[model samples]
Target: MASHVGERMSGSIGVNILLYSFYALSYAIPGGIILIHSLGGGLLDMMFSMPMSRMQESEADYIGLMLMAEACYDPREAVGFWQRMEAAARRQGEEVPELMSTHPSNQHRIEKIQSWLPHALEKFQTSDCQGTSAFADAFRRALERGTQFQTIYM
Candidate 1:
């Protein structure tokens, strides 16, 4: 049992590393282009780079969602997470037009996540892992607490 758990942990770690590496590469490519075009800094460079940065951010979110679903997490929780993010952004007055920002607008992210959810649910259903693990349950509870806190404060 211990060995099985260890193997699962190792696999999860490997998956996390791969996902993070992919995210870094995705960020670096657009960042490099921006750097080259800007030759340090400029408004035009920022204008060109914003779209690419937003695209990369959306891509990362998609990939991360898929990874979590593949790992047997409840992908529906992602919707709540994004809702919290949107709320936080609104509270901080950081909400911006989608095209002008480096990240997708919260609404865009929520829509994207919703659209991808059916596929994620299929993956989760087919996975051998049964129900949420203790850790995931704990995490979900924590997230719920956070959401509740946000609702109360913001």
Candidate 2:
């Protein structure tokens, strides 16, 4: 909802606006500068962090597959979910969500997901069929938040 204060303060307001104009400007200008700085700073951080984050995401996906399998859901859903995510990304054009973007694009990730399938299947079978913790167990635990991974394929 666009309230009166928000509407009046948002656009380019003149000096004769109100007594609070100075206060608003004082707050707004620095806030705007800070916002801009924060973005640039975030980009700088991503320059170093993106590669590590990508690795983390891949690790997460691998573990997430194990968790899904252990929970009796097919691990193959990772591929489909990633595909849909890539499609959604394409539809979004240049305005991708920043906070949601902590790793490589779905296009780059799909192949990795495909390659890891065989191992994941093996792990699942060994774990589920044998009743042992299996090799994927440690990874599953390490990727504690794997439950939230959006798989590339269903």
Candidate 3:
């Protein structure tokens, strides 16, 4: 929402006027210098934003895991999900270095999920909900058959 507001504001006439003025002022700059400046600015933005994005992704994973467990779904499946994702990424050659990516590696997510599993399991165990829903049973069967859960979406 904040980003949407910022975008809208930047497109307003006053902001666009200021932006155009700056562009006019910089019009005499050499194309090579402008390209280098643009690249450097982009690199700096990535350096600052990527780590924050990755951290937020990991935090979301943790929260989702806990929420699912609290709602009586098995937390162990979280680790399995990451493992499957890692396998898919490897097969597609989609893996990126952690420092350059906006999300943690699947293996890293798996390890973090495993570390948090015990607590999530406790939440599941203490919850009033039963653990044997149709979906849960089906998921377990799929895992037993070595089926990719990605094909079995809700």
Which candidate number has the best TM-score?
3
Q: Give me the runs in candidate 2 sitting further than 4 Å from their true place.
A: 1-43, 94-101, 127-154
Residue-wise lDDT of candidate 3 within 58-135, one digit each (tens)?
Answer: 878888988998888889998888899999999999999988887898999999999999999999988877545767
Model 3 is weakest, by summed lDDT over 10 consecutive residues, at 1-10
What TM-score would candidate 1 get against the native? Answer: 0.57
Alpha-carbon lDDT of model 3: 0.75
Candidate 3 off by > 4 Å: 1-36, 131-154
**Rank order by lDDT, top first?**
3, 1, 2
What are the runs in model 1 whose C-alpha is more than 4 Å off?
1-43, 131-154
For each of the candidates, the C-alpha root-mean-square deviation to the true structure, in angstroms, is: 13.6, 15.9, 7.8
Each model's C-alpha lDDT?
A: 0.74, 0.61, 0.75
* Model 1 lDDT tens row, 1-154: 1243454455456555654555555566857554544443244324545555676677778888888888988899999999999999999998888766778899999999999999888887787665457667888899999999999999
In candidate 2, position 146 carries an lDDT of: 63
Candidate 3 pairs with clashing backbones: none
The total of clashing pairs for model 3 equals 0
- For candidate 2, the 10 contiguous residues with the lowest summed lDDT are 11-20
Model 2 earns a TM-score of 0.48
